[model samples]
Structures are given as structure tokens and as C-alpha cells.
Target chain A: MAQMKSANVRLEKLNKHYHRVVAVEDVSLAIEPGSMVALLGPSGCGKTTCLRMIAGLVQPSSGEIFINEQRVTRVPVHKRNIGMLFQNYALFPHMTVAENIAFGLDMRGVGKADAGKRVTGALDLVQLGKFSDRFPSQLSGGQQQRVALARALVIEPAMLLLDEPLGALDKGLRESMQVELRALQRRLGLTTVMVTHDQDEALTMADRIVVMRDGRLEQVGGATEIYQKPASRFVATFLGASNLFSGKIETRDGAGALVAVAEGFGLLVDGLSNEAREATVSVRPEAIVVEPLGNGAPRTEVPNSVVATIDQVVYRGFINHYYLKLPGGSEIIAYQQNRTSEGASSFAPGDKVIARWDASSNHVLPNG
Target chain B: MSGRLEGVGAWVLYCVTAAMMIFILAPLLVVMSVSVSDSYFVTFPPQGFTLSWYAKVLQDRDFLDALQLSAVLAFSTTMGSLLLGVPAAFALVRGSFLGQSFLKSLVLSPLVFPALVTGLALLQLLSSFGSGDARLNLLIGHIVVTAPYVVRTVVSSLQLMDINLEEAARTLGASRMKTFWRVTLPQIAPGVAAGSLFAFMVSFDNYPISMWLANSEYSPVPLVLMRQLVNVFDPSVPAMSTIIILLAVVGVLILERLVGLRRAVAI
Candidate 1:
């Protein structure tokens, strides 16, 4: 009934080691109060291990977790007062919806009358109030997720944790639940951390995304920022599709740098120096513009442009996918937006084209 | 037509099943009718129906003592087996340890072992330990035999249950013991109910084990019934057996009402 204050969660140099395998490595982060951050990574990347550690379900090899500036590294899971929704929803089969929602309060020694009122409030919050008397098995998958959401929210936890909360739903329901869960989280202003390998879910739901790789933090930024400015080759590829090129930096300036990939051909890429010469440069597929060869040098000065022959053309409704072969025996894909009435069939095979983009589109990663 | 042939086959199958059911139960019906016959000796299609044999068996002090002994033994055996077997089932189902399969085989071996062999083994094991208390002897023997059923049903139930339910309970702030009571125990109630009834029936009707473990002054109902048949020539033995069968059938019915008998046995 009352608005609960969200708490800040900070992980200080968190590390989890199982035998010799590192699950999470030197991970440090600060989650602002009421903000939702997603730990996004591929499977076995320790995204789940970090979430479990925060929930106090797993012991960290070496780390400290603080909630609202209180150290909780040694706190048991039950005393942590955190709510977690599992991937399977995991609602108790034998209990009714109201009982499942009120179990946390009941465990806290709350009075039965008070628990009933809050359970009713929680059921209405998830819009499952009428189904309070029904068992979990009687409800559909989406309804089960909503009831699980109610169960997690009724406790008014200090921090809410979700382990792929909507992964079990169908594609349509998963998209809708993602929106509903985000709205609920925002409305309650509950500081939340969700672990998900689906990049789309993280981008759609989290305020900030922390990408991980091989049990280490790859990059941490906002969804668009992470996509536009990936910190490494792995992050660039892991976040989305990319076309990478190896080049030698020819010149450097305060604004950007010039990188030469082939003979007499240099692309002026922004935001790089001499140190970036040895690193690989990534260009997003959608960012590349593919035009027919006879168009001449564009009326507008195009900075980072390359000469390539079209190998294959795929019509995918909204966009035309042109698989282009660069002169250096490398292949890069360009997704041309289908804006006119012609749609994606405008491009065909064996057409020589200049794939170009702005200098700012070049993403340089340091060589390891 | 093939459809007509299938119909004939189905009719034959139903007849065969019914015949098998009667084949198994016909002797019990004979004993029951003989127990109610007015004839002095055991006979079917009796001269007249009377309950005098029931009164005669009820009046027998040895019969009453044996009934009380059997009831106590059955209750204790079921309780002990559940206490020991449920946790063992959990460990076997959830625990990953060296020799896990071996331990499972060891616990379940009693199910396939002959009751006479188990009885002999228990007598030797207890006598080797130099114990003379026959009630304790019978209690231990019954637990050894009956616990496998509890273990089996519980393992079956646990196998069918989702493991995430327990983890979800823990995340919802339930402690280990609380999670077990609130989540784990209720999911497996059918299997437990089934197992307890099986244990009770097996312990109550056991004869060979009770024969070897009988105390100097008393024995179980089954053992007493056997002794009556061996020493006497009357309808009272059938009367006692008929009462035992009725009690067993009633117990099965009550368990089926409480937790569906199909669910318990399916495990």
C-alpha cells in the first residue's frame, strides 16, 4: 500500500572460482537506487553466477556485496530480504495463488489478517486477483508468470533479482511480458538486476547493460551506447552482427585517424590513434550503404567507403541483405533498408558496389 | 471385417481379465462363506449361514492378544520405515556420491529377496548380537522389509516432481526445513500414503518372519492363524482370516479415498 524506497546495490571486486575455473572475475559495479541493470552474456559466462551471488544463494570466492550501504556478503539467503523469480516461475504446485504470493510475509511471522490484505493487494497488482484461489497448475504459462511476478513484488524486497524471468513464455508472450515486467519494475521503482543471455531482452528492459565474456566484464554501458561503441572485438560480435577489417593506421589527428586496408585505399575512421592501427575495426551491417558502381563519387563526401562486388542478395521484407566480397578476399554483409516500393529485391548478385559509411561508424578494438 | 475381429478380441480380453480377478479372489470368498457357515467343519455351500465362528474367534484370548500384537507391530513398522526410508529416498534421488547405485541396490534388495531368507538372516543377525527380545526382533525385521516400499514410492514421487520448486521456495525466504515441509512433503504425499499402507498391510499379514521372531508368550495375527489351522479342526481359523481380509480391504479403501490408490501404486 505504501511506496517502498529502493536501495543501491554495489558489488565490490566480486569473483567466484570453482576449483580452477573462474565464474565471475574481478567484477565491480554500482547499481543506482531504483535502476534496473541487466547482466547480459552468453551461456557459461557467469551472468547467472553473479546473480546467484547477489541473491545470497551462492558464496563468492572473494567479493563483498552491499545493499543500501550495508555489507551483506555473509548474510544467509533467507535473511537477505531479496525476491527472486526463477526461469521456470517455480510456483509451488500444491499452494493456491494467494498462498504462493503471501508465503514470504507468512514466513516473516506476519499476522494472517495482514498477510491476506497484502496478498489481495499483490494479486490486484498483477491483475490476477480473481485467480487467487486457483492452483498454479490451473493457470496458463503467461498467467503463471504474472502470479510469480506478484509473489516476487508482494514482499517489497530491497532488491529484486530475475533469472531469465520470461524465458519460458512463447515469443509473443515473452515480448509482452518483457514490457509488462519493465513497467511494473519502473512503477514500483524497485532496484532490480536480471540475468539474461538474450541481448534483445537486455536492450529492451535494462536501463544499463553489462556484457560479459569468459567470466569477465566485456563492456558496460547503455543499450545504444554498448551497440554503437563496443569496447572489444568480442563485445562487438556478441552484441550484434558486425563486419570486421584489419588495417594499418596511416595518420592520426585529434578528430580521428586514417587507416589503410589495401593498396592506395585508406578509410578515414574517426576516434582512433596510432595505437589503434594493430586493432581490428568493426562496421555494423545496417550502417553500411551499398550503391551501384555507376553512381560516381557521391555528391556528398563519403569518408570510410570500400569497393566490393555483390556475391548474394537476400530479400527479407524490411531490409535487403547484400553479401559483398571486398577486394582483399574478405566478405562483409550490408543490410540495405527497403524504403521505396521496390522492397528488398532491388539488389541482385554480381553487382559491383561501393559500401560506405560515415567516419564515426568505425569501431576500433585494441589487439590482445 | 477387421473391426469385428477387434471387437471380438476386446470382449475376450475383458473376459480374461475378469476371470483372473476371480481366480485370485475366489479362495478368499470361499474362506469367507465357510467362516459364516453353520457347519462345524470347514465347508463351502453350507447348510445354513451363521456368525457363530466369528463370535468363537472373537472370544479366543490368544486370537485377541495376537491381533493387538499385530496392530502394534504394523503401526511401529510403518512409522520406522517412513522415518528411515524417506530421507534415504531423498539421498538416493538427489545426492551424487560414490557407490550411489550400490547403495540403492542394497536398500532395494529386500523387495526381491525371499521373505523366508530375510527372516532367517534377521534371526541369525539378531542372535549373533545376543538379543533375546522377540518384539524388538520382529520390529527390526519388519522395518527392514517394509522400508523398501516407502523408499520406492518416495523416489518415484520425487522423480516426477520438478526440482526448481524447492529452489524457488528457498529464494522466497523459506529455510531448508520450512521448504521441505511446505513444498517437498506435500508434493510427495500420495506416494507416502501409498507406501505407508503397503508397509502396514505387509507387516500385519507377515507370517514367516513373525514365526521366527515370535515372543515366548505371544505372536502376530498371521502366525496365530497359521497355528490355529495346524492344531485345530474348525471354522474359527477361516473366521479369523476373513476378519483380517476385511480389515485389509477397509484399509485399502480408506487410503484410496485419502490419496488415490492409482497414484500411490503407479509410483
Candidate 2:
């Protein structure tokens, strides 16, 4: 078998327009060689359009695409030598797993003898070596997906592209396939660009995620960076639920800034000292810790604290979600683990409580 | 009581279906019986059965010529419509252009138009173009009438198919022609088969169009059979009809085996 040469894919100012509608704006991205990058966005956000452009399935109205430092913008899809897995698997129903996998080899003029060996290798990699003779309709959804994956990888293309690769599977199967697909891509060290609307799948499977919104890039980073230090308000809300507080910066200091929020409340944002006079800050629900007023002094040194009335305690399976109404009429949520019965029983509705979180948990955004 | 009622309802349904099948097949059975009758004249309770009429019909050189002409015309018409209609259907279904729906309706209008009117209109149009070869005119008329079935079947088949398979093939390094030939063609094959079968049967059994278009030199079996029916009553007419009916039955059986009867009926 020939060694697969992983490619570094780059799109420079790529733009796609369907008449007056802009499907993808001027997007420039450089994906590292042998890395699995994800284009994550909601539907119609142009993540798919970008992926299709890279695959040469959709032509860009302007700009260029490069794989392994060679311009391939004008190249036809078949000549691009890229592998793609469709959302529906698109496995040939009339063909067996071995025949589907051998399709790429036959196209490249590989002899029947050599193609047979490669097909077996690909099926084995997907852990379906014994199912090669079975037709696509004979297999389960996950099994069919594995065959699609085997078919794409058997060609040993320069880069792999997936358009919502696991979107068709049910929840349980989707999660397991995410893990398996990530492991396989890493093993092969093939640069892959997967487009998906599922954020958790992107975070779990991608080395770096590029988030898009309305044909524009929102934020590009790892999971924690986008979660803890979101570059924009959309990123913070889109990736996960965040309680946003709009305020104006009143003072600046070494540690942080004092921002005056609603109801004359000033928040001490640990890292927003000198950024701007007007800003927005975000705090995750899990970051806020709730304490009953009469429970005594706090053990943890949390500087930012707010007194509020307990509105609701939702007893979920693993946590008691505390919904607190603050003095400023804004609602804040705190999640307490259900590990101890003592903590679960400590809070009740309308009880006076203090919600405290570390000042470092405040993630300040520039505007909007 | 409910189970017994259900059984009775199922039995009633079976009886009704059986009656319907008999209703459809009775006329063909009558023709077959008359063709075998030993009597010189046609009668209902076909007198002592014999194979003489069939032999006489087969031996008639003019009848043979008409049957051969109809067979060639039907074959040519099937091939012509398939060649023309499949690509037109593909363009209509896949292409995004203005006036597409109007174009499709125009192509499929022959099915909705009255066959007599269509036949007269086609004869006028062909003659006005100054092409006087009666057989060629008949061929063209049959193609125009049969092409709609080909288009309809192909379009329906293409719709049911997974179009992403074509993209999958292209991404696998197969060129556009190869992708269509290897992937798209096989996926919609049932539709093509069904369409050609429909075209052949419609052309072979055609009377309304053939009557107006065929000349004496190029008379088809149906035209010849009609003339024979009008001139004099004979069991030989029934014999020739039986042969044609059998041919139609065999065509239907082949179609059912190639593309399931359920699919053909659904279309």
C-alpha cells in the first residue's frame, strides 16, 4: 500500500454568490496539514457552502483554493483527488461494501487484483472486514456509515472532506461514531475538513473549530478558548448558554475594571479594566455558586457576589438548577451538583440567597 | 364475532377483485375462443373448436405484411422516443431554467389530448411539412404519442433516486460521463425499462393515429384488421386479434419481471 500524503488546505478570500445572494463571503482560512478542522455553524450559515467550495463541488465566484500549496480553484471535482463523505452516506445500494470501496480504485485504473486487497484493508480499518460482501441495505445505519468512510479512505486521497458526515445517525450512534471517526482520522493523519451544525460534535472531533454565522467567520479556536474566552457575543451564546450583563466601564485597575451595570450595580470584571467604557460580560451558569444567606461566611474567596431571591430549584438528574432573581431584576442561574443530599436540601423558593462567582469568570466582549 | 366479520369482509374483497379481473380478461378470452371455432361464421358459443382459422390468418400474405409493418413501426417508435425523451426528461428535472414547467407540460400534453384530434393534427402537420412517406409519417406520429410515457417514467425514477450518489461518484475520481453512466443510469434503470415497455405497447396497439397516417402500401395490422372487420365477418379476424393480444400479454409479463408490477401500477 502507498503511504497517504496528508495535505494542508488553504482558502484565500474565497467568495461564492448565487446571483444576488451571498452564500459565502470573503473567507480566508489556512488549515494545518494532518489536522482535522471543523466548520461549525447553524443551517444556512454557509459552512456547507465553504466545504463544498473546498471539495470543488461548488465553484467560488472569486478568490482561490490551494491544497498542498498548489492552486486547484479551477480544477474539476474528479481531478481534485479529494475524498468526501455525504450526509446521507450515499452508499451505492446495488453494490456490496467491497464494491463500493473498490470504486475509487477502479476509477484510477487500478487492476482488479490490487483493488481487492485495498478494499479489504479499508474495510478492516473500519472494523467491518467480515461484512464486505454484504449490500448496503443489509447493514445498519452505523454499519453503512462505516462503509462510506471506508469508501472515502480507500482512495488514499490528499485531503478528506465530510459534509455533515454523521448527521443521519440517531443520538447514541452519532456520539459513538464521532469518537470512532476522530480516532480513525488521527490514525491516518489525513487533513480533514468536516462541516456540521452540531457544536458538541465539532468540539469533540475537531482539532480546531472555525465557527461561521451568516456567511461570515465568527470565531476560530479550540473548545475551551471559545467557551471561556469567546471573541464575540454570538460565539458565547451560540456555543453555550451564557448570562450576559451589559454595562459601562467606570474605573480601571491592575486586577480588573469596575463596570456599572443596571440598578446602580458595579461589577468587578477581572480582565476588562481598560478595554472600553461600554461593554458586555458573560458568565456561564455553572460558574455561579449559590449559598443560603444564613449559611455563614463563604469558604471560597469569591469577590463578585449578588444577593437575590431563589426563584426556582429544578431537580434535574445530576444537578439542582437554582434560578435566582437578583436585585437588578436580572435572572441568574446556578447549578449545584446532586452529589450531597445536604446541599440539595439547603435551598427553597423565595429564600434569601447570595450567588457568588470568581471575578475571573467574567468574560467581557467589546460590543454587541 | 369481530374476527368472523373480518374474514367475511376479506372474502368479499377477494370476490370483487376476481370479478374485476374477469371483467377485464373476458373480451380477450372471447376473441381467443372465436379464433379457435371450427364454424365458418363467428358465433358466441364457438362451435366445435379447431385451429383452421389461425392457420388461414397466418398464411395470408397481406396479413403477414401488415403484422411485419406494425412490428417494425412499433420497434422504431420505441427506440426513437427513448432516444428523444430520456434526455429531455433529464433536462427538465435537473436543469434550473425559466419556462421549464411549461416545456414539461407541452411535452406531456399528448397524453391529455384526445387521440383522434392528436392523430388528425399530427397528420396535417406532417403533410404540411411536405414529407409524404406514409410510413415515416406514421413512425413520427407514434413517437410523438409515446414519448410522454418515457418522460414521465424517467422523471419519476430520477426523483426517487438519491442524487448524492452522483456526487459521490464524481468525488471518487469518476468523470462526469462515467458518474452518470455508472451511477445515475443504473439507479434510474427501472424507469427507462418501464418507459420503453409502455412506448412499445402503445405503438403496437395504436389505432387512432395509425388509421389517419398509414397509406395502403404501409398499412399496419390494426388498420388491416379494421378493414377486414368492416368488409366481411370472419373467424380469421379473431385469429389475428388473438395473436396480437398474446403479444401484448407477453410484453406485460416481461415488463412485470423487469420492473415490478407494483412500481408500474404506482406510476
Instruction: Report backbone clashes per prediction.
Output: 0, 0
In Å, residue A33's CA in model 1 sits off its true spot by 1.9
Per-residue C-alpha lDDT of model 1 across residues A73-115, encoded as one tens digit per residue: 9998888889898899988877789989989888888899999
Tell me, by DockQ, which candidate is best: 2
Q: List the residue pairs that clash in candidate 2.
A: none
DockQ for candidate 1, C-alpha atoms: 0.43
lDDT of 2 by residue, A160-203 (tens): 99999999999999999999899888888889999999889988
Tens-digit per-residue lDDT, B158-236, candidate 2: 8888888988999999998898788888788888988998899899989999988999899999889999999878899
**Model 2 chain A weakest 10-residue run by lDDT:** A295-304
Each candidate: what lDDT? 0.86, 0.87
TM-score of chain A of each: 0.94, 0.93
- Fnat, one value per model: 0.64, 0.73
